[model samples]
Target: MNLLFKKKDTTMKTIFLLLLILIALNIQLTNAQPTSKYHAKLVALDNVYEGDVDLNLYGQNPSLVKMEWTEISPDSTKKTIHRVQYDMEAVLSFIIDKDTFYVKNLVDDEEKVRPYYLVRKVYGNDIVALYQYTSKEGVKRIYIGLPRRDPYYVQHPFFTDGTNMYTAFVYFKDCDALYQKMKAEQDGYWFKKGATDEQCVSIWKRIIDEYMNCKK
Candidate 1:
């Protein structure tokens, strides 16, 4: 009986060892995939918001824009990982965090923060459009009240600059579905369920401006 029990224990250990090895291999394989170049971020921004955002019209927050991360494929391939958010009902205000910066060279006036979300547009029938800033790992995305600027007003626009808020003949319009698919793929490709974060934000600004005028 003792000899038979010992043999069973040895078999179980062997099976456990094999399972571990297989798991490791699967993880490696998952991390080895590559991604295609996605220009959807530019398309959405240009098509929807146009040049209505930013002080200089590049559509970026004119304040502190800390470098964030870019997404990587499971196989360590670089991914675009374009992101979008919708806060049709969220507030829009400035971020005023005191003591956000520590002392530098014994300066008397400590550094202050004044983060804010400039207006941006959403470009998909799936995800709602937002004027919020791109989110990083730990930083907070603060919103304040500004209902007049909400894109949800597409049905009854109260403002316009060009071919923007016109009812072609007579109808309310919103973002298209094709743009939704493109945006989805871009957002999901780099957002691994449990992987990298802010470190992946590409430092290059041109990357987000390529398709600034593409159709949905």
Candidate 2:
């Protein structure tokens, strides 16, 4: 009888331990999955939509796919969900996870024109800095948008070859004193050999901030 009781106790303990292990594994699996749905607000040429949306922005055929939810009953108990594919050309902007993206026609070095989403980094009185992730290059490309001039790519201080550096400074020429100051401080600003992307972006933002302050 003593031996039987010991076996039963051990079996119960083993079952409890197994249950804990199963629960831990389930939690790990749930946390490992990427987010598939998000609440988003999109602005179009004539309409605005706000609801749960699924983004497929990195695939071969990138798109802004939105899932809209509507109340179907007076009590707001019944809801209907529908899928919509937004016309990329007609979309002006969108907000997701508190980040705003603007639709812009981006032209590449090869003169290829395509619509891409740009997130504003710095908006000053005279110029605005915008950036977008280039999945093919696995890096972010920054651009300067000026009045009456098409937005052009600017070299990432640490990532690129600095081919556009001259053009970028030229655009800043309107702010003559600030441009000269930035030109003189160019080496100190972005010449770090091994700075990270975030560091480079910070430096660029500081430069723009200085420009804005000087203009005022």
Candidate 3:
């Protein structure tokens, strides 16, 4: 009886060791995967909310954006992440040069001409789009109109410019499926249950880094 009990104990210990090794290998494999090539960061003007009006269009707020640009994939298959921090206000405004792009407020059918809450900024050769994140009424909500393409425009839009502004269209349209997938992966370790806004942003940056770095 004593010998049988000892053998059972040894078998359990061996099984536990193997499980640990397997877990380690899985983690290693996950971290060693591949990512995409097109990535850019707007590093200079993070907290400069009150800078020159031309420079900071989405006043008194900060946001981070990430995008996956792929031609072979469908537009819906691409991903964009926008994380923002700002005061709780009903509407936000912005301005763009006439040559850049035209944004119409579909709510009013009026062209966005004044310094009201618009999401994208286009200057010399670059475009920046902002998305204000909210979780009170729902999960990850922001609003903006699509850019009106200019035939004479020279610079192509960065993925951040084109995709980040369309948060509802790009993300929340299928948010339920995404949320479920994010929750199931790594037992929701990246942005765990009941995560704070800052924590969620951090997780987004981590995900972007992994995607950009070609990691699984």
- Candidate 1 RMSD to the correct structure: 22.9
Reference-based lDDT, each prediction: 0.29, 0.60, 0.33
Query: Any runs in candidate 1 off by more than 4 Å, and if so which?
Result: 35-216
110 in model 1: Cα distance from truth in Å? 25
Q: TM-scores across all candidates?
A: 0.18, 0.51, 0.22
Q: Which residue pairs come into collision in candidate 2?
A: none
Q: Which one wins on TM-score?
A: 2
In terms of lDDT, model 3 sits at 0.33
Of 1 and 3, the candidate ahead on lDDT is: 3
Better of 1 and 3 by TM-score: 3
Regions of model 3 farther than 4 Å from truth: 1-184, 187-190
Candidate 3 TM-score versus the reference: 0.22
Candidate 1 structure quality by residue, lDDT tens digits, 1-216:
999999999999999999999999998676443322212211221232111111211122322221223567889866754343423122222211211111111101122222222333322221222222323343322111112222222211211122321222112122243234333434421222322223112211111222222323
Report the lDDT tens digits of candidate 2 across residue range 37-131.
56778788898888776553432224445557665778888877666678766776668877776666665556555554444444444355645
lDDT of 2: 0.60
lDDT of 1 at 163: 32
TM-score of 1: 0.18
After best superposition, candidate 1 residue 118: deviation in angstroms? 32
